[model samples]
Target: MIKDIPEDKRNTFAAIGLLTVCWASAEYALDFIIRCVHERYGGSQIREAPPVSFKGKPPYLREAFANHPDLAGYLPQLNEFLEEAWQIAEQRHWCIHGSIDLRADASTFPISKIIHGKEHRQDTREFTARQIELLAGRASALSVNLIFFGIQTVRLMPKEEANKLLRELLRKYSAALPEDGPF
Candidate 1:
């Protein structure tokens, strides 16, 4: 079916693919931050950290970092990244989940989905290749920024405090771990 698309419509598909992949990269970056937060917050291992969905991650990390004084300087950037990341997630949801019109041009690519409620309605939105590309760029930037934030957070933590936290975490999870290891 993809092969049947006309040449003019291929750019839309490509743009959509870019957005999808970029957003995935952003998610991976967020996971890195999750791992850092889990370790910093006395999580023995990532597996021991409670499960959190993508939608819940930003708020959880924001609150966690806000409680620590060392992370104060980075809060502004963290808040900005989290806010933008949330916005991007919303756009990503629509673009990835909505149905596209194959006959539409790249400049007026239409994506629509049915909204279910007391009375159902169709929600349709148009996106140009340029707009999708811009979103992809933002997603890519967010991924890079998240990685830097995690790295900085790790570096800023005092060695003694980190060690103490790790020790406590290991102790908490020790009883459940096998003799060989958590594996």
Candidate 2:
């Protein structure tokens, strides 16, 4: 049955799957941080996450940290990570909103978004199979870093114990978490 499929379709589908997984990881990390902040601020009274959302996540995250008076002293390394993560801003935008052109052997994706009424045609990019795979790996790494860093730096949770609990939570929620995730 698999043999009947064309190579481009198979490859594109695989990349698409990876892209979704990577996207999910990033989204989960963002939501996780948001949830933690909300709960820490006494949102626990509602027993559900608030309806708030963020645009330009990095800035929002930084601002979120600032808003939490307690975390005002969050380590300089956390600030540094946020700065480095911003470097991927273009790639992440293109991977999600861009159109993918599937040819005989690979895919090229390009993205353009109007922000503040300005056309952003500057950051267009193309991706090969290897590049897409690398992006997936990088995205996963970014999320894991966010999870660990957010817990340690933002939540002020102890690294070893917090991560151990997080790993267990991830394992337990591995099946249901994605499905239950934000759309």
Candidate 3:
């Protein structure tokens, strides 16, 4: 029967919502990158389900690049970008994993984690509105950059190079594709 939550609690709730949106958008970007690679090289064999792990994406992209020499020289740069993205992902995880408790006089959410059956309040963090907004903005911007990176990688290749395997892949899966709409 929690009622009469203070204004600070309201902001805390909003911050949680914003962080949720941030993480989801970032995750979507990670998947979109892999999907682009599959479409260009992996053919119909690629899984429709999202990747099993977030950390696995960079390696998968590296492998994708290795398989296609034309996409070379991009892996190092991609790795650098991905490392930055991973740091954000780590922060997102920390926020998501922590429990936000609202106190009557506080200005923001106090985040705490439970360890060894005890709530370790000593390590708790107070997440301010600005911090939340910054995280969300970073996530949103990163997602856009990720999409652009994928597009740029594909476009940088020669037209024939880009679609070299795609044509054959489509032919291979032509039978699987239904005549009406997507199969």
Cα lDDT computed for each candidate against the true fold: 0.74, 0.60, 0.67
Clashes of each: 0, 0, 0
Question: Per-residue lDDT for 1-183 in model 1, tens only?
Answer: 778877557777788899999999988888877776666753334245643678778766766666666766677888898899999888877788899887764467888978789879999998877788899999999997776566667443444554555466678877333343311
Off by over 4 Å in 2: 1-5, 41-54, 67-69, 84-89, 104-124, 154-183
- Scored by lDDT, the top model is 1
lDDT tens string, model 3, 103-161? 43656667776544465444667777678778878888887666556656754244454
Count residue pairs with overlapping backbones in model 3: 0
Candidate 2, residue 59: the lDDT equals 56
The reply for model 1, stretches above 4 Å from the true place, is: 1-3, 42-51, 116-120, 155-183
User: TM-scores for all candidates?
Assistant: 0.73, 0.61, 0.66
* Model 2: colliding residue pairs: none
Whole-model alpha-carbon lDDT for candidate 2: 0.60
**Window of ten residues with lowest summed lDDT in model 1:** 174-183
lDDT of model 1, residue 146: 74
> Which structure is stronger by lDDT: 2 or 3?
3
| RMSD of each candidate relative to the true structure | 11.6, 8.4, 10.7
